[model samples]
Target chain A: MSHEIPIDDGYLDMDLLRFTTAGSVDDGKSTLIGRLLYDSKNTFEDQIEAVEATSKKRGDEHVNLALLTDGLRAEREQGITIDVAYRYFATPKRKFIIADTPGHIQYTRNMVTGASTANLAIILIDARTGVIEQTCRHAFIADLLRIRHVIVAVNKMDLVEHSEERFNEIVAQFKEFASRLNNIVDMTPIPISALHGDNVVDKSTNMDWYEGPTLLYHLENVYIGSDQNHVDARFPVQWVIRPHSDEHHDFRGYAGRVAGGVFKPGDDVIVQPSGFTTKIKAIEGFKGQESEAFAPLSCTITLEDEIDISRGDMISKPNNPPKKDQLIEAMICWFSEDSQLSPRSKYILRHTTNEVKAVVQEVRYKVNINTLHKIEDDKTFTLNEIGRVSIRTSAPLLFDSYRRNRTTGSFVLIDAQTNETVAAGMIV
Target chain B: MEEERHSYQVNHLAQLESEAIFILRETAAQFERPALLFSGGKDSIVMAHLARKAFHPAKLPFPLLHVDTGHNFPETMEYRDRYVAELKADLKVGLVQDSIDQGRVQEEKGPLASRNALQTVTLLDSIEEHQYDACLGGGRRDEEKARAKERFFSHRDDFGQWDPKKQRPELWNIFNGRKHHGENFRVFPLSNWTEMDVWQYIKAEEIPLPNLYFSHDREIVHRNGAMLATSDVVVPQPGEKVETRTVRFRTIGDMTCTGAVDSDASDLDSIIQEVATARQTERGTRSDDKRSETAMEDRKKEGYF
Candidate 1:
């Protein structure tokens, strides 16, 4: 079938929304994503052909949509997702990036990795099973990651004969558990049968009692405009662009993606940790000059006066500079199985564009993800465990609370010996 | 037209571009010696474009490394030369033939034999010879299943092996490029982009590509349901007949494995439209992936880009 490429304007105007899906093996998380892609016309015919062939070879009665997300050979053979697999799809309204993460108990670190940068999280719960411990664990992680939007998709409505009571019960149970957590501002609950194409793309006629929007409808319309920290005004210098050419001689610009807030031409800014103040002369984008630069927009900022600015430096409004501190407290998600986190252990801490040597000053407590309990007695953190810890860096880090600004407030700890990312940290 | 406001909203393409540029700059800053793996493919071209934009007035910090299999489309090589000369960037070629001649790798035998897999050895050898701390690839996760699991800052062992199960967790935008003396990192800036996204970006940015990407009459032969470009490297098997067909390459790999698709998409707009409705993936045409279900994964585990 021939398709027409619309004018570039349509492609240029679309916004991006990144969401994560967390569910146990049988919860149909893959099927939900597959349905979203299939119904949205994102899945190609050849992909369907491949999945169909695989499903038939595996002796499945129906075409298993889960095969779409289970892209790895082992995962496909085992019929389960083991790691975080990113899937892309687009509607006319917006583009989407789905971090389809495994929901097994041992894969908590995988869920965190997927949900960390997600603007929204979709927690799948089987209608027949109601809210299980896995459901609570998923919601807890979503909350811990401070995901602004959460959608509790009560799947398998077809198996439950489209029972509205089952959907309500699961929603109520999830809401009760979610209330105990923090920072999930918008929580939506919808009943869907991913396998039977009900309440996913189009409204399910089987569930007349349900009045909420379809999963696709909610996904397309969700307001993520205010998700970024537009008031903080933080820019972490990633690179210093200097072209030693005759035409553009003496051209020195600080290149970076705006971490937070808005930066306009002529704004008085401070360069940290040097604390040098300067004024922004112009903001250069890839195409040309931009009127203003906001969070996540990569641009080159030319200052009015030449100052010593380099990579790992932060540029912000002089009046509202990021917190410059050597000692910081943050919630840590230990990711490495090779090493455990303990007091006095030194690791390379990367925050924003800056990297510094950091030592664990204190292990405040270990968190029980399922129950959201803080075990104060436990002073050690192993793989897949979340804990609160205080770290002292060799140099000061410019930051804000992760709750205030996810970009600047997050950091990763890398083991020096192996260079493996051992843990993820969110500023408290 | 009214002046576009850059404050209230940022489009998806702009966002993706910004993220990619950020990653490119990060790689340049973190690594002492980094090289952009240029294959003269659409993805690589887009990557080169992004790299140029990342530094703008400044020249790219790293050179461009092309691991040549000695079996290439003439158009691709010419394009590569012109593109590098235009940017005034350093170009390094790691020849598979050189590796074969040096006894570092052996050439495969038979008609379906390709230097596609041998390039991995040449690539690793080149990395060692140049001491490149980081290799920027145009690999996108949406292209292949194994690639979907790759991190933006993927770590490789001293032996240049990728352990899929033991990958470091990549969270937020903080990438850990820290490694020991011998170990290097594989940085994929286009990890988030899809085939459609790449085409759309190319169209929007008006990025120049090899003419092979557009439709033209070429000598091709049908084999295993793919249109293989007729070349000295590809010896046709029994019962396979050559014919002239108007086609374009969806992907640009070694001429031995990369196939062409029958299309009339001679321009950027039409190509975008063709990609939008294409039934198969861009890699589907490549005979290399058709070798086995886990071919890409196996090759990736052994340090294939």
Candidate 2:
């Protein structure tokens, strides 16, 4: 089966990019992902054959690309996506992970879940229905999650005759609304027709007035290597690897993924909550010794002196330590249907690798996702509601502001009774 | 922009490995009694290798559990024993034969009968008997459409049922493994990995796999547009003729349902190339998924990993 195609060594150097897609109902979100996957040669022939057969059975005119993403039986029967479905594809330049999420009012939690770990977000806008409330809601969620890059794909441009004026009008409307968002570093608007494959993978001949890169080209070339916070070094120790064998009797290494900044051997560090200072004696990679470790890399660090470090403790630079506080304010998106969040409600707050009992002290305000307006009078939060609240924990939590570092500043509230995740929080 | 220039940059494979290791470690730290569900397949082998790397210089914290359907290929069983013995880890087996003997499950009767679906009862019962809180699987989203919508931390009810509509929203790297008594989680560290990524990683890391994955001369019977291996458990029916062909198993499962593809790829590089240019999905060869469009979904909802 081996062919004569030249295999380049550069193929092993491909990087990864994770992005989320959001749009209103019938906004062609799934279609865009399906087309991107199909054009990139990711979709298999059997998958297409299944979709084609289903489409013909359901009396569709063409092979419905949207059927590729609607995975669940209910979703396929109803012809809608109700949950976050992850899709994977790769090109010569990069490997892409798309978090294809729903864009309805009831599925805001799905969008937030998809956007939580994304480096970039793609918000689809139908050119016929320029910018609507659903667009604002998606943008607000993307901004609140602190997504750095956003691609405003104005789809269905062929329906509007590929009018540059229409595309510009939609872009202008998006910019007007985006002015209120924070932490949005870049927003690139591309005119595309996902159904017709126009300006999606290749440039469309119908839209000669548009002079922007194609969607696939932009996705492949976008730079996202500098997205992590590399200034404040923080490593939340998840486990302590102790090889009690005679071969390595003295092995006591801290195992964790580097949450923020860079860590190297011989760096002065402090253990959070314990307030003990130590120096890194060595760093262990999967195979051998590593000189340094950066954000998102999982490694083990052996300290110069053992100071009683365990799981849930953090390691950071002594000069710049995360704030340790019991009372913290954060913006939370409610994700529970069994109960509503109110004052005096107790739950288990999981921050980083630490879990502690926390009580809601006060509800400052709730924001209307459609308009991004604050509602100070609403003291109760139900499912899919976003609000700012203060919580007092049983113990002091070592954390940074979500604006500074996403890894250290995010948390989830788990209901101790039902053992279900009730809300997602970002520390302020 | 100038400050973005760094001396080192991790590639996609390295990044994925780190992510999987992180998840594996998190499961070890969070769960009280967890077990790795080993199927002796390529994905499980890759996962077991990652687990070894995650806790170097120390034995695995959890044991490996294999739900035996009594219809596995001999090569897979041989590979399973060798791998487990080399790791020096504990191994537990849940046999479907025992379930049938105890009157806990009934066997299907037909020419196309498979013990694949019957393993669910044995699996859930084993979890109950062992009180395993977390069971790590090698399920990848790219394998099936239902799996694409599954979470890395999939929750199961007290009755051992998965409610696809009521899944908890997983955010960032924070996984909620909290569960009440009798409830458990099915953790998949390789949820984000694709088929190509697995093969590439295996080749890059020089991971060992079963000989069944490689092409070999075997007696096969073409049935229902699929080439099935003629094993002791799978006998050829009347009008079905067995022929010798050079074939390889894309996925290993119950011999009755698992199918083989005719190919000539004998090595890692050749197999990778074959997978890259392959027209059908890995699961397309398996006759189990041909039962219905949502067969995997139905099985998954009933606690099938």
Q: How far out, in Å, is residue A139 in model 1?
A: 1.3
Q: In candidate 1, which residue pairs get closer than 3 Å at backbone N, Cα or C atoms, i.e. clash?
A: none
Q: What digit string (tens of lDDT, one per residue) describes model 1 on residues B183-258?
A: 9999999999988889888887778899999999999988888889998987777899889999999999999888
Model 2 C-alpha lDDT versus the unseen true structure: 0.90
User: Model 2 misses residue A49 by how many Å?
Assistant: 1.2
Docking class of 2: medium
**CA RMSD of all predictions:** 3.2, 2.9
TM-score, prediction 1:
0.96
Label model 1 with its docking quality class.
medium
lDDT of 2 by residue, B71-123 (tens): 99999999999999999989999999999999998999988888999999999
Which ranges of candidate 2 are over 4 A from the true structure? Answer: A1-8, B1-4
Superposed Cα deviation of residue B63, candidate 2 (Å): 0.2
